[model samples]
Target: MMTYQEAMDFINHIPHIGKRNGVNRVRPLLEKLGNPQQHLRFVHVAGTNGKGSTVAMTASVLRQAGLRVGMFISPYVEDFRERIQLDGQWISKEDLAEEVSTLAPLFRQLQQEDRAVTEFEFDTAMALHYFARKKCDMVVLEVGMGGKLDATNCIDAPDVSAIASISFDHTQYLGNTLAEIAGEKAGIIKMGSRVAIYPKEPEEAMEVIRKVCRQNSIQPNLPDLSQLEILSCGGEGSVIRYKGKQLHIPLLGEHQIYNALTVCAIFEELNAGGWDFDWETIQKGIGQARFEGRQEVICREPLCLVDGAHNPDGVDSLCRTIDRFFAGKQVTVVMGMLEDKDYAYGLSQLAQRASRFIAATPQDTPRALPAGKAAEIAKSYCQRVEAVDDPAQAAFLAKSQAGAEDVVIACGSLYMIGYAKQGFLREE
Candidate 1:
């Protein structure tokens, strides 16, 4: 039996065995493991920005409806175990290690056959196998990247395939244009699956998704965003009236309102398919749903927040949230980003609102933009800019420099937000 640390090490060290061949590389290995995903029901979610929140909201609602729900997300903000969850609880270390032990021999065998699995492939397999063994009634699966080649797309037709807020993030892999990227994300829509889409997506992207749904003989359900009425929105959360029901969403930001509406649209599809979830239960679930690191307020003394807004779209949402809630305030921003992202656009947007800017490097990623380089770019937009190589130190410095009534925000990359949160908590 492998220990938890050993299990994580083994999973993390798995080399990229084959070329990027879509689901072909992972399919055979899953076949050897008894094809566990085929035995599971899924609500497959894909998009650039809001996928995580949508998955969390969907899983929470399903769990509230007395179903055993499993959730699979990617690039966890804090812990590795966060990627795989059941009934809102993370998979235990003991179960993770046990599953890794069971799969080790199969992984070795695949490697010997020139079919080695990547870390994500192994993680997806483990999640499906564990969920199957636990007899979950449903699994909310989030796509890691572009939907067509993402490891989570290996599953069969989902009960509902949802595409949330599409934007320019992975242009190198997905495509440069909105239509092209939408085409890649639309790959998750299977023949028999019901589909839901965020109502406010760009027309170009919507056209591509509409074309795909047309080809599949499916009409995608979209949330009526115009029907959404914001009763109250503050740093705590938002109160919105949707579908003739006033509900409280615990996640912050107006963008989260959009995500909650998308979840509502998804559940409408599920209810139509005979899930039988009432609006009360759905409202309870939405109010109970909480995901960390997205406009998360870690401290209130100096008003420190940490957000994983690495791309232009995410930054735009964050900026709007700030402008709405903390208007006419002195704001200091600690930002970090990956080199592969549109860091310049994100930094420029953040700089417009930041009284001071501290650039930091994201941890544990080879593609992290250098802190000095980010600061140089930020200086073009903000008058006060400093480069700090350590994310935690940058967070601490930002908080310390802000007045008691001022605001300090750590944003940009999820890879660095965890460390920034640690610093903020320590300050608190």
Candidate 2:
């Protein structure tokens, strides 16, 4: 048996199947493990952005209704254990080690198949097995990349499959166009599943979703966007009125409001499907739901906010939120990005709202765009752009120049935000 740290090392080193292409390996791997995903109820969410917040809110609502919930997210904000949780608590290190030890041999055998089992596949299988053993009432599963080939899609079917706001992302694996990306996301809509969609999704995306629903015979569950009214929004978050009831979500950005709307639709769909969670519980869940790395406010004195806005759509949302919340304040951004993302568009979007920009490379990612390259591109968009060695140094240099009221925003990749948060954590 391996220690917890060793088990983590084993899992981390597992190779991916062609950089997020297909889940052929995960299917057989799960089958060998008795297909634990089939034994549990799930709410599967896939999209370019907001999937994390949507999954978190959905899990919180289910928990608020007094049910034991399991959550599995990808590219964890800080810790690997954050990827798998039972009722808000992370999987214990002992449990992770045990699960890994039990599956390690099977995972090795999976390599003999036509395609090798990737890290994501092994992680998905382990999470499902643990969730089944724990007898979770529901599991909120977030698709790691494109839905069609994502390992999480190994589930037979979900009680509710939701597509958060789909946009241009992972263009290489998913397609170049919006509809193509939507089609990949729509792959999560399977047989015997209820579908929920972001009310404001692009027409191209919604058309693809509608077609998938038609083929699967699942009724399209759409949120009534008109009923959602944002009464107040600021650095803390937003208070929105849905129908006649008001709810507050601590996650910043209007994109999160749309995500909450998608959650509301799922709650209604699940209630009609016999879950029966009340409005108060749903409101409470949305309020209590906590997700880091999406406009996370780390320090009030320096007014530091870290957002994982790696893609164009996400950057646009982050910039809009920053503009709304800190309209007249000086904003200095510490940015980083992956090589494959639309960094030019993302950087340009954030640059529109930034008074000063410090570019850095996201820590520990082979795909990271170099700090100098990002800084070079950012200079064309923003007047003041400088390259820093790393996210920690970029944050320090950015903060050094900012006054008390100026907001030090870190926007780019999740890894960048993760590194920036690490600096704050070390202080504590």
For 88-172, candidate 2 gives per-residue lDDT tens digits of 9999999999999989988777666555777777888999999999999899999999899888888887889999998888787
- lDDT by residue (141-244, candidate 1, tens digit) is 99988898888899999999999999998898898999999999999999999999987899999999999999999889988877878999998899999867
Q: 79, model 1: CA deviation in Å?
A: 1.2
Supply candidate 2's per-residue lDDT for 314.
88
After superposition, candidate 2 runs with Cα above 4 Å error:
19-21, 113-115, 425-428
Q: Please give the lDDT score at residue 343 for candidate 1.
A: 90
